[model samples]
Target: MNVITDNLGMLGQGLVTTLTIAFIGYACALVVGTVIAIFRVSPIPPLRALGAAWVTVACNIPTLCLMILAAFAAPRAGVPLSLFAAAVTAIVFSASGFVCETVRSGINSVSKGQIEAARALGMPFGLIIGAVVLPQALARTIQPLVNIFISCLIGSSLAAAIGVPELTNVTQQLNLRYAQAVITFLTSGLTYLAIAFLATKLGGLLERRITGREAHA
Candidate 1:
């Protein structure tokens, strides 16, 4: 209580930084993952292969390794990044693989008959995908995407290792300063748990609303 009360402002800033990293990272991951998913489903063999290779590499590498590479190696490779950018980049790179797979699964769940009908109507590949596939696929993917967002949020803690001073980093600092590791860590854990719970509940509500609308339509 003393530690928390004394450092409320610092904790608040840390929370904000954590949320910023998570949201930015997840948003970038969503865009990149969706593009890769499109590539995986593309008629062109090369695109599919490229998508496959990306998923294979990204999924196989550990997030911490990616963080190190982005934070340390990239600079040596002439691509410098701030700590925040490196953290977000690592999250985007690692999480995009799962996002791609999740979106690909959603795309596969779309009715084949509808796709066939669109093709029969002489719709171009892009048009058919944009009009007849993506909407339905994305709709089906809301819950899974929400889960990915939650994972991204939790994973942002790893940014602390790279000195981004996010929630976990601040908690560690407070623990050292106060010599109250248990209470400080517990407080941080509860904060994460609360955020995750709220996100889950909101995701469920959104899923239900979307499902109801689709049913009525």
Candidate 2:
């Protein structure tokens, strides 16, 4: 009530920061994850092993622990990062593991018969993957990737642990100042819900458009 009215600017800034971190993290994760997924599916055994190792390590470690290490230990090891960078880095690293797995699953979902047909037609590996496999695989993966994006958005709140001043952190600060924990936290919670709702709706729309195009093609 009064708490929110009095701190509209603060909440707004926090929301912006949250969105910035989440979007950047998700974008980086998508790229890195795709690369890792390729590696997992590579003809080279070493590349597959490397991708497996990455997924195992990244997925095993907790995201918060990764953030703490990035924020604290990295500086001690002579790789200094601002709080924001550390937060984004941790989010990207953690989210990429899940993204990699999701994409690999999508890759696996591609029709083996189609791959065999392409090979029978003498298509090069790169051409087959680029022209035939990836488009279909990516199309099938839209919903899972969208779910990952939403997870990344929610996970961005963990940045508050390292003083990133995102929505959760701002809510904590306001709560301390105003002593209105319920109202302050509820406001932040509702904001997160609203953003997630919008993201899901947009994702559904995009999925439908892509599906329609695929059907037509």
Candidate 3:
């Protein structure tokens, strides 16, 4: 605490970087996950297989290893990214797999009758998916998405490994300077808890709103 005071501003700057990386990663993951989930449930065999393979590869890899591989290997392979982009990209690829699986379950929970009715009404494939399937799947996916978001929030701490200067990394700097690992970690934990709470509550509220609308309609 005492030893860290002079560097608190620097630490705050690092915290912002952490949040930015996490947000970018999660946003990208959300898009990738949605695409994967859609493909996983598609009628096309190759698309489904591709989605499955991606999930297996991404999900099975360790976080730090993925970060390192993405950060370092990419340059070696010729398609290079900065440390921050690499960390964010790795997080997106990894997190998207779990989110894809969770969303597939949500898609499954959408009743078959909805699809049948949509087809019977002459709704085109795209229309059926856009109008009927997605709404229901999204409603169900909300809770799980909230859960996924919370996990991402915690996992973002790992960005430190790639020199991203995220909250955990900044926390480490503070701990090193002040020799107050316990206090620094506790503060970081509380900040994460607050983010988790907000995510859960807001997602739940949105979920309920849509569900309520569906019920009334």
Tally clashing residue pairs in candidate 2: 0
Candidate 3 lDDT by residue in tens digits, 144-189: 8888777777878888887888888988888886788888888788
Query: Candidate 3: where are CA atoms >4 Å away?
Result: 3-6
- Candidate lDDT scores, in order, read 0.92, 0.92, 0.84
Candidate rank order under TM-score: 1, 2, 3
In the range 1-217, model 2's lDDT, one tens digit per residue, is 9999999999999999999999999999999998899899989999999999999998999889999999999999999999999999998999999999998898899999999999999998778877888788878888889888888889899999999999999999999998999999999999989998988898889899998987898
Better of 1 and 3 by TM-score: 1
Residue pairs of candidate 2 with colliding backbone atoms: none
What is the C-alpha RMSD, rounded to one decimal, of candidate 3? Answer: 1.6
**Which portions of model 2 show Cα errors greater than 4 Å?**
none
Residue 186's lDDT within candidate 1 is: 95
Error of 1 at 34 (Å): 0.5
